[model samples]
Target: MKSPLAGLSKFDFFGVLLLRIGVGAVLAFHGYPILTGGGSVWTDVGKGAAIASLPPSFFEYAGLASGILQFIGGILLIIGMFTRGTALLLSIVVGFAIANLIAAGSFQLGFLAHLQMILALLGLVFIGPGRLSLDRKGI
Candidate 1:
């Protein structure tokens, strides 16, 4: 005895699909430049905030990891495969970035971005990955 609204699974699938894709794509897009070493992406957060205390190696690895995760997570989110898991992981990474910024006394911009990321991650955690996801199909 499913409710009438329960039958509208397709809409739910695409809705969640778009959310995941959009978020992931943005993250990947933002991360790509820094990861490739074309230039520093953390000019505002890392350099502008705490260049004196931050090591070059730390910046290098952080850039690489952020780019890789966002790129991979974005693609997976678009395809609806491992949506929640990827979102969770990316969320954690975002958290780390925020933490870094805060530690560097760049709480102004970093705090805002961190809060936004937290919201996105929280949505994925509670939303169950939507109907269009691989997890859904497997179920």
Candidate 2:
């Protein structure tokens, strides 16, 4: 069968490039600080996880894992290397973040940012890296 996205054109590819870069930058911005911020950041993250009813160990390990995933995934996404895999992983992370925030009664405007990021990442997952990316051997 033909691919559903076979109709996507060069313009769509450009749009995908913009989306990938924007989402990648945002992920890096949020992740880099946590990764480099030392123990206190992990403590805070663990506390947030605790508030969301996760296990106590989640903060120490999962927090670090999350940061690493976001940091590395963001870089890969921006470079268009393994774009689908990166977007998919980041989408899962963002989805979990949204779920945790909502579960913790944080239904405020800030959570909207996570929701938007999830949507954008999901879009990238479906659209692929586009022609401007390294995935396509572009510059």
Candidate 3:
């Protein structure tokens, strides 16, 4: 008796679903602190964008916005709602941050996570949400 899921060997959609769940959970966890961190946390997050040379207050607001995007976008990814659009926006944000880190000569071990995120986002953008997603069922 072969495995019950042996027939699913060719089922790539399950892979997409797993990817969405894994990445979505990570992003949601990542955003939770920043989202609830208030002014200080926002300030810290904004500092990453300081390369833009914007005003101090602008950094704080930008951080808050980043938190919201990650939190909300993560949820959308998990449920397969607005999957492509959400992943597209997240790709932009992740790409910018990764580029900045590389520019800053911070290519350390921690940088791998950002690299993985960008790749995953790109995959989602190109492959779509698949039939397991709400986007597919018109939900």
**Full-model lDDT for every candidate:** 0.70, 0.82, 0.87
Badly placed stretches (over 4 Å) of model 3 are 1-7, 137-139
Local accuracy of candidate 3 as per-residue lDDT tens digits, 14-114: 89999998888888888889899999999888778666667889889978888888898999999998999999988887876787788789988767889
- Model 3 residue 49 distance off true place after TM-score fit, in angstroms: 1.9
Model 1: per-residue Cα lDDT over 62-135, one tens digit each: 55667678778767776777877888888887877776767768869658977797688668777857876677
Candidate with top TM-score is 3
Give each model a TM-score.
Answer: 0.68, 0.81, 0.88
C-alpha lDDT of residue 38 in model 3: 99
If ranked by lDDT, best first, what sequence of candidates would result?
A: 3, 2, 1
Better of 1 and 2 by lDDT: 2
- Two-way TM-score contest, 2 vs 3, winner: 3
Residue 65's lDDT within candidate 3 is 84
Question: What's model 3's TM-score?
Answer: 0.88
Instruction: For candidate 2, write residues 18-134 as lDDT tens digits.
Output: 888888988988899878877778667556544547666677776777788889899898889999888998898787788779887998887999888998988888888888888
Which runs in model 2 stand beyond 4 Å of their true positions? 1-10, 47-55, 137-139
Candidate 2 local Cα displacement, residue 81, angstroms = 0.7
Clashes of each: 0, 0, 0
